[model samples]
Target: MNTEKTSSQPAYEPGGCLTAVARGIALVVVVPVRLVWDALGYCLKHLWRWVLAPLARALGWLIEHLLLIPLRWLWEWLVVPVARALWWLVEHLLLIPLRWLWEWVLRPVARALWWVADLLVVTPIGWLWRHVFAPVGRVVGAALAWAWGIAGRISRAVGRALALVLWHAVGRPLAWAYRVVLTPVGHWLRTYVGRPVAEAARAVRAATREVWRALFGGPR
Candidate 1:
């Protein structure tokens, strides 16, 4: 008799068939891209290291030796000396004399002018403002206040007199007419004419409502 044995373990499942296929495709595509990128990087690295770097260094050295050195020397020797001499000349010849003139002549003249201006303009103006204008303004203000008080008193008195006259002339007569004449007349009219007219109107409305109800079908 021959016997066969079967293993009873679960099979390994790393994702599924789709994931494996996708991984295979990714590897196939990425290998060439990675190889190309590496080759480009290597080439660029060597190119920069050997060719571009040397060229840049040579250019920098040439600039430093030829252009920069000469410019620096010119600035240090020619430009600096010329600038110093010109500054010295300006300071000695022009600025010094101007400074001296300003200190000795212009300053004193300005001071005298200021003193004269103060005496002629500022002092007189200050005096007038303090003595003349201030006193006059105070007096005018006092006069205006007194006149205002007088006017206010006169206005009050006039207003009282007018009120009294109006009360006697117009208000008292109107009050008497309303109280004595119009009150009796209004009461008589309301009693005789208004009551009769109101009663007649009520009768007419009641008759109209009755006629409408007789013609139409509605609640009585």
Candidate 2:
């Protein structure tokens, strides 16, 4: 009994040594990996949040508020006023003299020449027209009027005779036929055909409006 050992107890354990060795190796590998991961995370968070993000926001605000806004204000206030003044000086100084010369010198000379030509040529033509041509024109006009009056009277008499014959021969029968047959037919067609056509057209228009509104979502 003193020499026998319990079966649950091991005298020399080989697996226990192996487990201790495995735990030591895992701590050696995982400790460095975890330290590198934590260091990388800390660097990234502080770099962006403290340095890069603030610098970018400051640059954007400086450009928009200070540089771009002042440049626009300077252009509107200084450059625009100088440009308008230059244009005004050019128009008043250069164009005004040219306009005065054209109006005062050139226009008057052109008008004087026109008056001389009218006096020399047009006055004589007018005298001749009034004194010589007018009398002949009046006599010819009177003769033509007399001939036209005679022709017109003959034409009037012929037209009246033809009109009377037409009325007796054709017009009375046509009028009678229209009163007897065509008038009632026209009235019946207007009452039946026209009313139904108008109603159908109204219904078609209403349906078209409804379809148009359905498609386009608006009043027709």
- By TM-score, the best candidate is 1
lDDT per residue, candidate 1, 51-85, as tens digits?
Answer: 99999999999999999999999999999999999
lDDT of 2 by residue, 1-220 (tens): 5456565566888999999999999999999999999999999999999999999999999998999999999999999999999989988998887799889998999999999989998998899899989988999999999999999999999999999999989999999999999999999999999999999999999999998889888943
Instruction: Give, for candidate 1, the lowest lDDT window spanning 10 residues.
Output: 1-10
Best by lDDT: 1
- C-alpha lDDT of all candidate models, in order: 0.96, 0.94
Cα RMSD for candidates in order: 9.8, 29.1
TM-score of 1: 0.63
